[model samples]
Target chain A: MTGVAGVVLQVLLVAVGSPLLVGVMRQVRARLEGRAGAGLWQPWRDLRKLMRKQAITPAGTGWVFRAAPMVLAGTALVVAAVVPLVTTESPLDGVADLFAVTALLALGSVALALAGLDTGTAFGGMGASREVTVLALVEPTILVSVFALSIPAGSTNLGELVAAAEANWLSLLSPVTLLAAVALAIVSIAESGRIPVDNPATHLELTMIHEAMILEYAGPDLALIEWASAMRLTLLLGLLAGLFAPWGIATAGAGALGLLVAAIVVVVKVTVLGVALAAGEVFMAKLRLFRIPELLAGSFLMALLAVAASYFLV
Target chain B: MPDLTYTELLYLACGAFLLTGVMVLWRRDLRAVIRLFALQGLALAAVIGVLAAHQGDLELALVGIGVGALRAGLLPYLMARALAAGGEDRETRPLVNVSASLVVAAALAMLAYAISRPLTELAPSPATRAVPVALTVLLVGFFVLVTRRRALSQVVGFLLMDNAITATAFLTTSGVPLVVELGVSLDVLLAILVLYVLTNRIRASFGGTDLDELRELHD
Candidate 1:
């Protein structure tokens, strides 16, 4: 019963905390731009409105058109379940390894790409092609960076990685961790369709990689995609915060009080990261589509440096 | 007792090699061939996982999962997308037919088994079992690369060759060090990305993924 309760609590935290993180980012961006933003609960309100609205689908769409959002949301939920967002110990921790987490993310992207191509629109197909092209590069960076960390940890489990990071003598100063953190941050932004790699706010089809793919979706479907998108952004950020900046996360065997403290730490860290991401978006313009490859290649090079640094430094 | 005997695993690895060779002969579609390649990866991963889990080594478990995820899951997924995007379906014309290909693959496997037999006899039980299987898979993968006209199949064959090497490493000893295993997997992942990018360019340039067209290249 206690194990089940822990699982339930961790899941609820991820589900509830993700949108709040998104809302905080929006609020921070608005404040940065010298305008009062919507309340932190604004994402909830928007999601509710979207849920109640009628769905409108374009003609000539197939089953994949309807299935994409569900798959994306499902994938995000699975990732949240597997990743230790608030605590190092969770019931579902051992069932999934880091490789599984990576697979879940890749599954989500593939579903989105299929959905984009199913529309038979030029922009959708183009976006789908470009997204996979970026993915083919970005996925390796994610794998390599995490592998560098996993090597020192001696395990591929996320929980183990975090514990090792906390217990290690040079967790923060290790060149491998440093390079991986930077590589992961860049990959996170690219994977989540954020600034420099992709612009989330722009409706201009020519420049939009993520938005262009989902132009045909509206109402409930769009809401789910948007929610899943927010959840994914938060999930990736939380993963980064937990693995790289795992200062306050509840260690295994810590009691309820420890968990509560960890939750607070997590919320604060993710909120701060959300703001930093927003600031980055506010400061930088999106890279050209062709230029996106260079950014991914640079991240891959950084990840390679991380592994080499681990070997040389340690 | 261990869950599986070392000799049984050796014979099983050899059987898996033969089965994958047969799979290569059976597949006609470019995408289907990639799927077979992934299945071959799964078989190798399973054997490695068994060996690692039996020996109670966490490093091998981690390596097993990483290889399974990359070779069986991500690589196959990427290749499938490339094939779909390339749209070269129903147009597969191999450089060699199935019967002739199977005969050649069988001959190659026998040749590899004969070549590795003496060296393997000097090794330990598990290592000896894995050696021939590794060599056969390697030879067949290269054969597939040479015989397949589709660029996608060639890429799958390339990855299969890597899988054979990794399997050999695991069977030859307890396992490679964790650092080497992670590095090799990362290397394979990067190689797959480059392959995907090249496939796209190949599609755009030739309007088909057939290597026959690419052979027209001359400088």
Candidate 2:
């Protein structure tokens, strides 16, 4: 019963706290670029404002477009519940395997892509095509890198991997862990449609990948998609954080102190990650679409090397 | 002296070496290619350092220092000068395209692994487990040599192949004769100097370092 409580709390916190992460990133990026940006609470205000506006559905769009935002947000929320956020003692621990979680993410994005294609706009089709290309190249790297960590745990379950890592944090120093961490880091940046892969802040049709798909969306629907994007970015960052450094994440059981310790630790970790992401965005140019595959290929090689290193280096 | 950490580091170096080979094919800029070649040389020197520390061979340490200083440091410096002197920017054209060469390079790597399995099994030391990587590096180096059209890039490929073979020999045997190691090191150093001279000569005479220019001699 306590475990179920923890699970529900984990889902609520992740969904609610995720937008603050985006605001932090925006502010950090602005500050890094020598301008005072929006307040840390700005994303919350924007979401609230968006929710009150009228929902506009364009002609030629039917059920798919109408339901896409809800589906996207729901899928992301399900994944958030699946991660061992505050406590590994969640009732859903068994449901939180790596492949399944990654598959759910893919399904959600494919839903968005299908919605984009259904709209019959050239920009939407272009964005969907590019998203699929990025997805195909990135998914293998994600799987292989996660598998590198799971080699020792003997299970693809995310909670078990973190538990195994917490038991022996020294394993983090292994070349396999280090390499896979690097690969995951690159894949995260690419997956989230950030700089160097796609620029999220840009309005130009040529550079927009994620935004183009949502161009026709308005009001509450647009808000949900935007909120869902923030949540997705935060969840992936949390996954990377938990995988590489499971410290301060509750594994055995949590008393009040344990939960607090874990909460503080997670906040610090995600803050550092958001800042790193923003800092990286500061200097990187959006890579030409052709050049993006080379970057992803490099990550794939890193993941492959990680697997070989784990097998032979042991 | 710990086998586990040593094994991990060896595998790490091998991975890095293989990555450098892949990077050489992936990069089009001549300067980046030479830098990667130099990085490979640095990784090779690191392997030498590890092997020497494990075997406690003072002469091997000296060889590592020589190789590190020469191949990783001076050789890259010279190549950069050669590139600057020739005023060429990239390997703009190749017999095999970059993407095709990358695929072929991967196939060549697997072939190197398959071919070297018997030799890897013959070695007694745990370090010999990395021999497949050395052979792969060797073959990938040869791949780079045959496919690239630039004089400096070919020089890098030749040096890369030679370095891989030498690392494999030393890794399997544990230690080479000090005099032999020193002799090979000196020979490479001298050969690079000569190569530099030839690079400059080619540039001066032809205004470029593209080896395709020499094909006009069908006497």
Instruction: Give the number of colliding residue pairs in candidate 1.
Output: 0
Give the DockQ-based CAPRI class for model 2.
acceptable
lDDT tens digits, residue span A174-285, model 2: 7678879988999999989999999988979977888888888889999999899998898899999999889888766577677767877877898899999999899989
Candidate 1 C-alpha lDDT tens digits along A1-314: 33444456666777887778888888888898998999899998888998999998789998999999999999988887778776767778776588888888999999999999999999899889989988987898899899888887888899889888888635555546766888799999999998888887786888888888888889999889988988888888989998888887777677777777777887788888988899878889887676677567666655664554343233
Which ten contiguous residues of candidate 2 chain B have the minimum total lDDT?
B98-107
Residue-pair clash count for candidate 2: 0
Residue runs of model 2 more than 4 Å from their true location after superposition: B93-112, B211-214, B217-219
CA lDDT, candidate 2, residue A241: 90
lDDT of 2 at A187: 91
